[model samples]
Target: MSVDDGILEHMFESDFASADDKTVVAAIEECARAEAMLAARRLAATAELTARYTEPDEDRDHLAVDGWRMASAEISAAMRVGDRAASSQMCIAMALRERLPKVAALFAQGRLSAALVSTITWRTQLIVDSQIAQRIDTAIAQRAGEWGGLSVARLESAIDSLVDQHDPDARRRMREAAQNRDVRLGKRDDVTGTMSLWGRLSIADGELLKRRLAQLSSQVCKDDPRTAGQRRSEALGAIAANAEGLSCRCGSPDCPSAGQDDPRAAHFVINVITEANAPNTEPVPATPAESATAERAAGPVEPATEPQAAEPATERSKPRSAAALIIGGGLIPTPLLAELIKNGAKVQWVHKPPAAPETGYRPSGKTARFVRMRDMTCRFPGCTRPAEFCDLDHTTPSPAGATHPSNLKCLCRIHHLLKTFGGWGDQQHPDGTVLWTAPSGRTYFTHPGSRLFYPGWDTTTATLLVPTGPARHGDKGAMMPRRRRTRAQDRLRRIERERALNAIDRKRWAAPATTQPSRPPPQNDDPWKITTDANIDTTDTDPAPF
Candidate 1:
C-alpha cells in the first residue's frame, strides 16, 4: 500500500496522454503557437543582450564593456551557435530594433521567419549607401509575405535585381569582384572522401566549367546506375586529375582505369575497419548486423610467440584474399568492397585492445576499442554520432567513477557539453541501456546498436522512471545515497532557485494570437530541377564579416 497527499499537492507535471487525433492535433498547434511566441521572446532577449553590449555613441562605455565580441561569445556559449553566426544574428536583432520597425512588427506577428529576416539583412548590407539600404529594406519589408514560398535562388535573385535597379555602381562592383577569382580546397567530411571547394570565377570561366562537366557526365552509359550527381562528381575528379585534358572513364568493370592506378592521381581512400563476424561472401547484406561480431570475425590470426607492435598502415598495405568492410561502421556491399579493394585501397583492421587495470580513471586503448565495439555509436540517448568519433564520457564523473563498461558512455561534443554544463542527467544500466533524464524531469531511454540490424542480442529496455518511497514506522525521511553534485546538478539547482525567486505563471511566456493562419504545403509539382549559381557553395577565401 502507498499514500501521498502533501507531496503530490506541489506537482503540476502529469503523465496523462491523449490518443484522439483531434486532441493531438490541437495540442501540436498549441505547442507551435507557443513556440512562435517563445521565438519572439527569444529575439527580444537577444536584442536586449546586444543593446547592453553595443553602443551607437562609441565614446559612452563602448557597448557594455565586454563589447560585441564578448556578447556574441556569451550568446554562442549559452545557445550553441558558431561565433560568426551568433554575431550575424545579433546584428540582425539590433538592426530590427533600431532601423527596421516594420520587420520587427512582422516578427511580433510571428508569421515571417528569422532566416528570411536574416536574408533581407544580408541583401541590405550589400548596399553601402545608408539611404539606399533603408529603401531596399522598406521595399523588401512591404513584399515580405510574397517572399514566402520562393526558393533561396529566386529570393536572392530578386534582391540582386532590386540592388541592380536602385544602385547603378552595383554592376561595376560585381565586375571588380569577378576579377578577384581564386579557388581553395576544404577538408573531407564524409565516408566518400569528397572535399569542399571554395572559389570565385569569371562568368565565362564558370559557364565553361559547367559545360565541360555536363558534357562529360552525359557520356555515361545508359545501363549505368550512377546518378547525375555521381557522374558530375566523377567528371570533376577527372578534370582535377589531369587539368590540361579530360578523361571519359567511369572506373566500372569495363573502364580503362578499373585495374590501373594513375601515377599522378590520388586515390579516394576510405578508412574501413574489419570486424570478426561479418560475412565476406557473395550476396552479403548492404548493412552488416550490429551484433554479428564473433571471436574470429576478422578471420584466422595466429598469435605471435613474441609480442611485437604492428603498424595499422603497414598491415593495410599487406594484401588479403577477403575482408568484411566495416567502412565508417556502415554495411557496405561485398562487391563494392571487393571493387574498392581491387583498387589502391584496402580495409584496415582495428588494433588489438590494450590491457588496462579495472580501477583506472581513464580508459585504455583496449577499453576504448571495446567501448566503441560495444556501443557502436554515441550512447547519449537518441544520438547517432559514431562511438569512434565521439568522446568517452565517464557517466558518473571521474575519481569516483571507474573505467568500466557500466561507468563509461559515449557523448558527442555538443551533447557532452550540454550534459556536463546544461543540467542534463544520465544513468547507465549493465546491459548498455542508457536512461537520460532531462532538466524537466522527463526521462528518455536508448540501447546500444540498432536492434533492427542486430536481431537476437539487443535488449528492448527503453522505459519511463517509477517513483520510489521508503516505508517508515515513525517520522523519518526517505533514505537515499548521497552523491557529490555535478556542475549540471548545480545548474539545475540555479534554475530552480531562479524559478522560485520569480512568480510562477504558466501562461506568461506562452502568449499567442487568437488564431494562426494555416501554412500551405509546398507544391513540388514542378518536376524539372531548377538550380542556380547561388546554390553552388562557392565559399570565398575571404573571411565573412559577421
Candidate 2:
C-alpha cells in the first residue's frame, strides 16, 4: 500500500513528537534508501546514454580527445559542474556497465547505493587479474548491505585485503606503481606570484619532509599572529635564506649548506630501506642524468655478469652506494640526492620495526613532532589544514585514553571542537586511520596523509634520517673558516692585468720590419689601368705629370 503524502508532511512538521523512536528511525533510513534508489536510476540512464555515444562531437571533428571529455564539457556548460567531475562520473558509469554486472544489478534495484558502488568499482579495478577481480566482485556482492556502512578507508582496505589475498603479485604491482612517483612545481601566477605543488612521494622521503617542516614550523617568534599554513610558508623561505647565508650557492643536495656557519642547519637524516645488489663487475650510476647519459654513451648498460648470489643476505647491509633511488620514491631528483651525498649526508639503515607505545596525557615535544610528521595534516574527512595549526586530539579521549602515537591525531580547531562537543564519534585504528561516524550514523574515514600512498612502507623506519652534511659546498670533514683575500693582493692583480694590456697595445701599433708594398710608378701611362687623377699619388711630386 502507498503511504499518504500527509504522513511525510506530518513527520517533518511534528519533529517526531507524535511518533515513537522506532518509527522515526525507520522513517529516516527509508528516506536514505529512497534517495539512493533515485541516484541509481540516474546512473543507469547515464550509462545507457554513454554507451550510445561511441563517437562524441569532438571525435567527429578530428580532435582526438576522449569521447567522455566532450560529454563532460557539455555537461559542465549546462549544469555548472566541473569538467573533471563530469568525466569521472562518466568513466565510473562505463566501468560499472562493463566490469561490474552484479553491482549494476544491485544499483538498479536500489539495494546498493550508486556512491558506495562507485567506491567499490573504482578500487576493485586495482586487482589486475580478472580471476581475482571476479572473486572480489563475488565477495562484495555477498555483503552489499554490510559494506554500505563502511567508511571510505575501511572499504578501500577491505578491497586491498581481498586483492592481496587472491593475487600473488599484488605487492610487486604496488611497489612498481610507487616507483613512478614524481614532484611538480607549477609556474607562478602573474597576479599572485604563487605556484601550486603536487606530487607522489615514497613514504620515507615524504616522512622526512614532514619532520623537517614540523621542526622548522616550531621556530616561531613571539607575538606572531600568522596562521599555521603561513608559518610553514615562512619556514620554507627560511630554509632557502639559511642556505644562501652559508654561501652554498651550488644547487646540489650533497652541498645543501655543506660547509655552513650553523651546525644545526647542516644536520639532516634519511633512512636507507633497501639497496640495489649489483655484481662486483659494473656499478650502477648514482644519478638519473648519469644513468641516462651512461646508457647513451655506453650503448645500453650491461647487466652484472658475475653473480655473487652465493653471498649471504647479511652482507646487503654493508652498503657500497648503488644509488639511493629505491628508498626515496623517485620523487627526489638525482641532482639533489647527489648533492646530499656529496655533503656527507649521514645515512642510516632502518632496522627498528615500530615505535614502542607511549602513555602520557599530553604529548612531549618529541612526540608531538613525530605525530605531526606522521600525520602531516588534520585527520578530519576532507580537511587538509596542516597539522601545525591543529590540536592533538586523543582518538579515544585523553586521561582515560593513553598518550600513544596510535591514539593521538591532528584535528584542526574547528573539527576538534566538533568531535569534543558535536554529535560526531570517531575510532582510531592501530594503523593510524580514523573511522568517523556522523550524528545520523553515516560513516567516513581519514588516514595519516604521508603514509597513504605506500601501504607496505616499513613502519620501523618511518622515523626520519637526518643527514649531518657539511655547512657549505666545500666544507668537508672539519669545519674551517675560509680566509678572506687582502686588498693588497687585489690591487697587485689589477696592476698586473693593466700592464699586460698596455704592452699588447704598444706592440700592435709598432711599425713593420718589412718595407711597405711600393706603389706602381706612373701607372697613368697604361690606359687599361684607368687610373683617375685623384688615384695618382699626391705624395709622388704632387702627381704633376699625371
Candidate 3:
C-alpha cells in the first residue's frame, strides 16, 4: 500500500507528465493562487501595524504649539472630504469644545503660540455665547476695512453708543434736546408756511430711530416732507394743548373761530391765533384799512377747499383719431410685430368702425405676454432695457401680415417713434444682416460677423456683408437675395467629403495592425511626416497556417 500510494501522489504533484507535455500546469496554477493570497494577507497586516504605531496620544491636547499646529492641519485634512457645511460647524464646535480653553489658558499663562492663539480665537468666536458674539461682531465692524473688518477700539466705541442710546436714563437728555429745537419753515400752497420735523442720526442708529419715529409720528403727527423743526413745533404745540388747564377754544386746531365758547375744543383757537400771527400766512382780501384791521381781529380765515377749473363746452365734442381707437384696446398680433421690428416698420392702428362687432377686432392678451417672454429686452441689436415699457411694433401693416414670431421686435419708446413716425426704414438681409435707411436716403448696414444661427434665430446663417447704398423698405431693399440649394446636391457634396475622411480613418485604424505603434513626434521636429511600412521576411513558414 505505501509504495503504490507514494507513486500516485508524486505523479499528481509533478510539474510535467513529460518534458513535451504540461500536465503540471494545474499544479503551477494552484501554487500561484496560494502565493497571491499570502501576499495580500501580508499587506493587510503591515497596514494594521502602521496605523497602531501612529495613533495619537490621549494627553496630546497639552502638547506644544507645533503639536497643535500639526493636529489642526490633520483635522482639516480629515474633514476635507466630508460634507462642507457640516464639517465647518463641526470644526467650530471642536475648536470651541477642545482647543479654545487650552489656547485661552495657554495665552493667559503666556504659554501659547501666536499662530495657534489667533486660529483658536477665531474658531472659538464661532461658537461663543451671544454676549461674546456681539463683541466679535462689533470687533469685525470696527476694523473699518473694505467690508467685514472691525478693530477692537472702533467696536468698543460703537458698543458704548448703543448702550447709551438705549439706556432709560438718557431719556431726559433727549427731551432737553427736543425742547431746545426750533420749527423748520417750508413752502405751502396757502400763504402760511408749513413745518417739517425730523432729525439727523448716526448711521448705525439711524434706522432704529427712524423706525421709532415713524411709529410715534403715525400715532401723534403728520410726516409732511416739510421742515423737521416745523413738525417738531407742531408736535410740541399739540402736547402743550393736551397738558392740564392751558387749552384754548376752537373747533379745529388752525380755525379762525378764536375766543369761541367751546371749553372741550381749546387747541383749535390756539392754532387759529398761531396761524394768524404766522408771517407767511395769506393776506385778507383788500378793504378799508380800518375795517380790515377789525375783520382781522374778528378772525379772518379762508375756507379750505380744493381748487377747481371750469370746462369749456367745446371739449366734450372733440373727436379722437382712428389710430387711437385700435391701440387703446390692444388689438394686434405679435409675429407680424417682430417682423415689423426687424424691418424697422411701425403701425398706426385705426379702428375701422366702432359700430362693427367687438369680437371682430378684439386682440388677444397673449400679444403682450408673448412679447415679454420672447423678446425680453429691446430687439434693436445692442439695446438691452426690459421690453415691458417698449412699444410692441408690427413690421408689416395689420390686415396685410399675421403676428408671427418672425414679425416682432421690441423697440424702446424713443426708437419706436423714431423708426415708426420718424422717417427711417430698415431691411433684413438674406444672411440675417440688417440694413437701415435714414430719412436722407443714406443706407447703413449691420454686418453680423461670426454670428452662429440656430433654428428660430431670424438673422442670417452666413456672415453678413454690408452693402454700400440706400437700403429702402419693401422691394428696394431686396438686394443680394440668398441663393437656394437643392437637397440632392448638398447630400452629394457631403458624401464626397465623408469619402475623403473615411479613407484617412481606414489608414489610421490599419496602421498599428500592420506596424509598431507610433511614438510622439519629437520636440522641435516637424509634425507633418511621411512614413513607409517595414517589410518582414516570411520565406520559411506562413504566420496564419490555421
**Model 2: ten consecutive residues of lowest lDDT:** 304-313
Residue 277: error of model 3 in Å? 79
Return the TM-score for candidate 2, rounded to 2 decimals: 0.34
lDDT of 2 at 97: 73
lDDT on C-alpha atoms for all candidate structures: 0.53, 0.53, 0.34
Off by over 4 Å in 2: 1-17, 55-62, 77-79, 126-136, 161-233, 237-546
Per-model C-alpha RMSD = 21.0, 30.2, 40.8
- For this target, which candidate reaches the highest TM-score against the unseen true structure? 1
Per-residue CA lDDT of model 2 for 1-546, tens digit only, reads 588999989857887788798998998888777887777776666677566644434323232222343344333333334445655677677667766777777776778877788777766543445666667667777777787778888877776666556653331223245857998865445223344677999999889878776677654443346666766665554565453232233344565444443321134333333222323222234443442111111121211110000111123324232232221122344444444434444333322223554655787755665566456577766565666667998876645566766678898765665566444678777657778876546677667764653333322222222224422223221222222433224435654554455445546646476565666455666665545565566564543453
The count of residue-pair clashes in candidate 3 stands at 35
lDDT of 2: 0.53
- The alpha-carbon lDDT assigned to residue 42 of candidate 2 equals 63
Winner on lDDT between 1 and 3 is 1
Q: Model 1, stretches more than 4 Å misplaced? A: 1-101, 107-115, 124-140, 149-154, 157-331, 341-362, 373-387, 413-424, 431-546
